[model samples]
Target: MNAPYSRDCGPPPWAGSGGAPSPRPRRVPWLSTLLVAVLVLAGSGFAAKGQPDRERLDAYALALLLLGTALLLARNRWPVASLVGTVATALVYLGAGYPYGPVCTPTAVAAFTVVVAGGLRAALWIGGGFLAGHALIGHWLYQYLPPTGDPGVPWGREVVFAAWVAAVLTASELVRVRREAWARERLERAAAAKRRADQERLRIARELHDVLAHSISVINVQAGVGLALLDSDPEQARTALTTIKAASKEALGEVRQVLDSLRTPGDAPRSPAPGLDRLPELVEQAAGAGLNVTVETVGVRRPLPPGTDLAAFRIVQEGLTNVVRHSGSRVARVRIGYEAGRVVLRVDDDGPATGSDAGGSGNGLAGMRERAAALGGTIDASHRDDGGFRVRADLPAPVKETV
Candidate 1:
């Protein structure tokens, strides 16, 4: 709900206000007393044979009047209790010659309270009770007061009073419902934002885990090999050192790619996202890491969408990482081909693996599959019969424009 009232008014114990601000102040004890005083003055103004019955509303009537008025101040917070007090005061006022002053105000407020708190049904029943008690007692008073020729209680006055009470109650209820609806909408928006944030975090987490885990794993192995061969075979050690350098550089580039995603506004443009054009560099990096990385492209090629191209690049990068980490031999094949209505990619390695070697647990494969599916494509992953792993992705080819 919109914020509640900022301050306390009069600090009256009867003010039952909390949560959102009420249309009226929480406590109006002084207002209630003033209203009661006005009602007493008005009742005292009623004429009996050319002179006002100023003494008719004595101490008893005045006490009932004040009690009923006080109840009005607490109607919102303690609706049922205030309603009971108003009803009882109405009876007392009627028995004591109909104090028309503050008598009706408290009952009217109580009826309104029921309506706003309990909807139309409560308003209807409470209003009906009010009218019945008031009309019955008013008719009795007319008979007992020795007719002052003021014409009996007109039906229009009761109708007008009921209409005024109903209008106030309904308007308050409508405002309450609208406020609640706005609050619910705000809550739904917050929940949706939280869900989107969580999904984004998971996407970034998977990308970092695949890139860093796979890249650093290769660097670690190459470093170990180079350290072992430092004395007997200096040439092979040199080659291992060279491979380590290339892997470290590629790893740094991949890290930079990840960091660029977090740039603030007005920052310089990042390195362009890797796509098909960077396939040659990717293959060379893998070849330097001791895996035979090869590339073959066919058909008429055109510029692909960034998302599609990025997906293709990551699939290749991850597949090559897998080959070096899983397979023991140096020969891994890469293939990229464009054909009718589709672009196909495949990476297979026929390298020998020792008993301790294990292929990936399939997170990278799943990420590739998800990316391909997002573009209305598919992917397949399985082990080759030649004792190696194969990763394949098929992406729908965008129709090229004939310029």
Candidate 2:
């Protein structure tokens, strides 16, 4: 799966300071930084308006405001601490009777900081504290400091300003939260795509493994027998040579498909998958491997349901392969029949029994059973009292109505 954005696409617009790509629950610092910048500009502009006699504009006031604005940059990272520091410094300026510069710019950064990190609840409390502090200072100036330069308000405007502050904080935080949600969605889609790719690769691996694993095992056995009999028995050697040739051909075809998968973008487009019609070829291969494979038809061999054909084909193929590998039996029988709205396949071996072969836990039988169950069918496998291993599968074949 690809990353959310390509290298050519670049990072999103909201990416914050430190070039941190948008995180889920976006921790973007730009909006917060903009808020601080605006407040700094506004405060600087307001402070510039009421200059103390140019002679009295000292180094101390310049030092405090510059330090406060610089501190605001760290707001998102340490909201509570930054807010506390900004609030403390603002209080000192306000206490000096709204001295010659914009005193509330630092407060704007503090208020916005609380909203972004701590959310609306924190904003409410922090905004309330700011307003309360201003009202108290305003009242103090009116009552004792002899009213410095027309600070006018009927209490309602103060309430409205407080509401505006809350709205701006909430709106900015909402933007960050939404960007985070979008990042999460993109990440989830990427993960889901990766999982699907992995599962498909595993399925292809299983198919390639089942196809060549069994065929090569047969070829190995026959090649060894052919080498042993080359000097002692010419006819037997020749027969084994023929078996090796047939196994090699089948293995080569299966390997070609496996390698083709790597070159193809995904599943290769080719002929349809092998199905019931190909069962005869599989049986012939087994027969060539020196197994006397007999096939019988007990019911109508009509066109089967689409999915049923492939399932039936794999059942027969695996069954015959198992017989070749595990059954020391020289003779095997395959019976295909239709009865009671279902198709049945029964492959059994009647030969000398090797205890290891007869007593084995067979994944071939298990896979057939699973396929049968998925089709609303059934499967049964057992060793007969007559010393034969049998596999039976019943697949539903509901007749289609003529159109």
Q: Please report the candidate that would top lDDT against the real structure.
A: 1
> Model 2, range 21-95, lDDT digits (tens) per residue?
223343546655555455554544454445442213346655556666566666656666666676666655545
TM-score of 2: 0.71
TM agreement with the true structure for every prediction? 0.72, 0.71
* Inter-residue clash pairs, candidate 1: none
The total number of steric clashes, by the backbone 3 Å criterion, in model 1 comes to 0
Model 2 misplaced stretches (Cα beyond 4 Å):
1-43, 50-61, 90-124, 138-149, 264-268, 296-312, 335-346, 350-387, 392-403
Q: Which 10-residue window of candidate 1 scores lowest in summed lDDT? A: 1-10
10 residues in a row with least lDDT, candidate 2: 1-10
lDDT of 2 at 227: 93
Residues 1-403, model 1: lDDT tens digits: 0111110001122222221224564554455445544653354344211233222656776677777767766766777777778777766665455323334555555655665565557666666676676566555565554324323355665666566556656665776678678879999999999988776776676667666766676677778778999998899999888888877887788778777766784676477777889878777767666667767777777777787888888888888877777777677777888877778889888856554544455577778887788789899988878878888999987866788
Scored by lDDT, model 2 comes in at: 0.63
Which candidate wins on TM-score? 1
